[model samples]
Target: MGRHSRKGPKSSGPDIEAATADAGADREAVRPVPGTGRRRRSVEAPAGSDGHTPFQQTGHVRGGHPEQREPGGGWGTGLQQLHRGDDHRPGARPTAQQQAAAGRQQSTGTRPLVPGPRREFVDAFDAPPAPPAPPAPRGPSIPPPRPADPSTSVGERDEQPPGGGTDGPAPAKDGKGAKGRTFTGIAAAAVTTVLAVVVAGQVTQDNGGGTTSAQPSGVDRLGPDGASRSDDRPTPEPVRAKPLSYAQKMAKAYPLAPELKASGKFEAVPGTAKAPGRGHRYRYRIDVEKGLGLDAALFARAVQETLNDDRSWAHDGAMTFERVSTDDPDFVITLASPGTTGEWCMKSGLDTTEDNVSCDSAATERVMINAYRWAQGSSTFGPDKLFAYRQMLINHEVGHRLGHDHVSCGTRGALAPVMQQQTKSLNIDGIKCRPNAWVYPPS
Candidate 1:
């Protein structure tokens, strides 16, 4: 018997992948034309056979119709003849249709395609469908470009409202118009009142000095040496220093931790002398902590400016202020850090740290201002009125030096007195007063 075949369940042929690796795998793969069911497969030789025959080759145009092939394994069309067999170059083999056409060409010597340029070859059997026409031309080139906007000479265009009125706000309802006119009148009146108050308080055309009264017009009693003698003038009424308000706890502590100078020395501010008759000219000194980071000059100027204002200590024409650097100044206003304030103002008996209040240390003769309070105004006086708060702080502490007593809010919503202990609550008499920096009303 012939050899009993034991190579059971054998593959019909070698996969295209194995044959692909045998060739340089870098070559492009061979594939049938799209839409063509024709397959180019491998027909391996029998297992027992020697692998040397051309039939030992891997993939080929298999299952070709005998009629499609030429009479003797030749081409049937004018396609270029394929590399006969086992050429290692990939993609060199003809497609099945090309192979069939080559066979026909070998049989008949005539070429089906005449190689010529400049002409499209659309095969009805394989060409794709025709393209669509381009979109219709967009409508008449819109807007035709406004005639160069009538040149700049057209003066400024009055931008009319959508309602077609001339340059003005759109017309409102009748009721709205009436209300708007009323509001405008009220606003104008309010503005006039405010202007009057501010003018009176700060200055008036009547008095060159902001105060209602100016320095008493007594001739300067010059000494025999020509210096004005101070002893000749009557002593002015002393401004008592005891502004009062409730001792309210701080609902919240100040948030800033500023850098301050620890230097114990004091620096005096520079300014001009007060004119005679404004009142008894009082000399004062201003100093800041050595490393206290604050602009000492600016702070001193603010204090000086505040005190010299018509609405301030000098407002009543009873006293005028002169910033001095004398060894024995009437008073030394010290901007002190919280810690320093505690030491210098310990006798004041206020918590320098948590109380956040400045003190006029009667014993030390120093107006010790808590730098924290200086930087951050109190809760009673919100930040919006920061400048006013600063002014009030200066006035209140200096009021202490001037012997002023604490005073409660005299009337609800009225401006609190400068001498009020307003760093605390102003509502001692169930009347919440607005924060005020000036002792006297607007001139």
Candidate 2:
């Protein structure tokens, strides 16, 4: 290759120059440069052109370097490539303020040089104040108190004397209010106890004193001879004879003695009217105070009904009712007789010679009821209810007549027939006595 280069160097230079001239002549002959008049602008704006000026060929400017005088603003092509897709545009360049900020950051090496937390943006106008150090906690505070005996708290001490009061000489009061309340409560309890004891003692005295003091019975206690005649009252009563008989026809109509055959004894008795009535078997004797408290016929009917209903169950007998107008029998069926006249009845051959008629013990038969009590608001229960009540009363008396002993349910429930001691335990108001609610079985 060295030998071939030496043979051609001088000669080959002139020949190559002649061929280049010929090729230039040929290109000149093929294409001529245009004589330009008006030039069309480029369509796309120049890169980094700030989106304003039309695209200009910077080369057309006479004697000007195109790169130095390019139609651009903000930042240039190098920045556009470097910061591609960033919010800062492609050719955007840093302002003096940004350059200063960058210089400061570089000097600080990016480590936060602030001694503590940076102030908020609002605190930027003022110098940052030093942070306050946390306060040390103090122990619970208490003032020095007045001295007391080491052995006891203030409450352990007694209350101040009345005259001494609570001056400097007195100790602090801790349980003063509590002590007062305690004393007050104890005194009240003691007073209550004393009152209870006194009441109990009085009650005992009332019960224990055997004698029932005489309550004056307002009557003539002296006779015409001026001698005490408490037991010397004239007595005269003899009623017309009434037959020992079956009950009246009305009584039989309502089965007044239905249990009579069952128990082999009579329960529903014939009640005499206030006036004599015609009947075949017995001439009815009229007693002045005969059917007193209740509708005597209706009362008798209820008793009959109860006897009839329970005959198959208990076989209890009917009970007899009589009057206390003629003379007192074994049990006095006394009525509520109210008058100033002194007589059982004028027709019954009894004397009407006293100021006030007393309970005619001689005319008494068995039971007594205050008719006035019934006439008043003694029972608010209606006819049927009263019938039930009267039936209860009859059942009570008949229970005794039937030789059934009184019994207590001990637990609360309906009244049992055997529990029929009327006056002894006649507390119907306190206990329930409905039909199905009976506590004990039917006798």
Candidate 3:
């Protein structure tokens, strides 16, 4: 009996022998299979026994080798042999048979064999060739051309390179084309900025002063020192008239007849003069009757100066007087014609028509100063004494307003009281007295 006689019945005689021979040859041709612990043994036919092979009862195919059988023994074992057949040396080329086997495996929808470790083979016939290196530049390298402006029409865009090739517009030499446009844009902006600054400066100059001067008018051709002047020289200030001095105001006589009747309408002198000292202050307004031909400003000035004099009612800081135009004043000192003065004084039951004199209208806010007495001097205090006479008149009338009454000189020849009706006469009951203009007359 054969060595397999104890194992199983041998079914097919010739087929089993042929399959056993092929399986033995395959085991010798390759390394051991990865997972299987034992190798396949050859099954011999039993001598003088039935013809069925024992492997047939084990489900092994009759004519096929174990590697060619289904599943567990056939296809899986074939794949392992394919992997083992590859040469695993570094950089070794794959054999033509190996590549053909891999292609065949792929074509059959089988997984392609993975090469073993340390084997790195590339199929030269299948891999693409390496690209050639770019050519060196002929001369100086040029910068790439700038993109065409989207705003430009196709015809206006840069022409193609010579020979009509699809190369970009020819590169600019030294990048001067792009640099020139950049420089031009910068220059234009700088010029625009300068112009804007110039215009703004001109506008500021014009607005600084209330008026604009194309060329300076009324300019002096020469300076005060007689040097020749250029047109660019600063314009000269206007020539203003010098203000009148106190003596000049005093010396000037205004024209108004003693009996001249004026329009009774009066206007308050427009200004304010603050009292000069810390004293009991009395605020007063000065009003001049219209058409009196008097210098109202001069009269207002005289009243302020006189009342504030050290010898007058404001003596020794005992009292102060402020002249105002707008506020409610303690009293309004009015310079009016004799008719207006007499009319105002009559309201207080004082008959001033007999002497055409000024009076304090006790019944009203006005303290009237006769324009005739103010403009023309009285016979008692003649024209040469006009300045003193005017002062006396103002003091006497204002004194009455301050609650003083008529009084006369007691001595043979003494300065009359400022409250005296000095305009009528400097004498009372046959005794003559000198003129006085202040309550506290100078010693």
- Per-residue lDDT for 1-443 in model 1, tens only? 11222221222243322433433343433321111223443322234453222211223322211111121121122332223352222211233454344334424544335323212223432578778989978532222223322211122112211222222223344557557756766776776787778778676645445434444687665667887888767889999977432112112233446434366655555553443336888877877776566667667777777788778778768788777766677888888887788778877665555565788888876899888887778778886666777878888888888998888877888888888888888787688988787877674
Candidate 2 ranges beyond 4 A from true positions: 1-296, 299-364, 372-384, 401-405, 416-443
Stretches of candidate 1 off by over 4 Å are 1-265, 269-277, 347-351
Question: Using alpha carbons, what is the TM-score of model 2?
Answer: 0.22
Tell me the alpha-carbon RMSD of every candidate.
35.6, 39.8, 29.1
Query: Could you tell me which 10 consecutive residues in candidate 2 have the lowest summed lDDT?
Result: 1-10
Deviating ranges (above 4 Å) for candidate 3? 1-244
Q: List pairs with backbone clashes in candidate 3.
A: 10-52, 10-53, 10-54, 11-51, 11-52, 11-53, 12-52, 12-53
Tens-digit per-residue lDDT, 1-443, candidate 3: 12222333233455434434544655422222222222333333343545332332122212222211111222232223423345311211122233234334434644434343221223443578878989986633334456654432343243322222221222343477557656766776776787788788888877764555465677655645787667557898999999988767765567888788899899999999999867899999999999988788889989999899988888889889999997589999999999989889899998988988888998999999999888887888777778888888888888888889998888879998888788889879989999887888878
Candidate 3: Cα lDDT at 348: 93
> TM-score: which is higher, 2 or 3?
3
Query: How do the residues 209-244 of candidate 2 rate in per-residue lDDT, one tens digit apiece?
Result: 554435477744565698867557666678778752
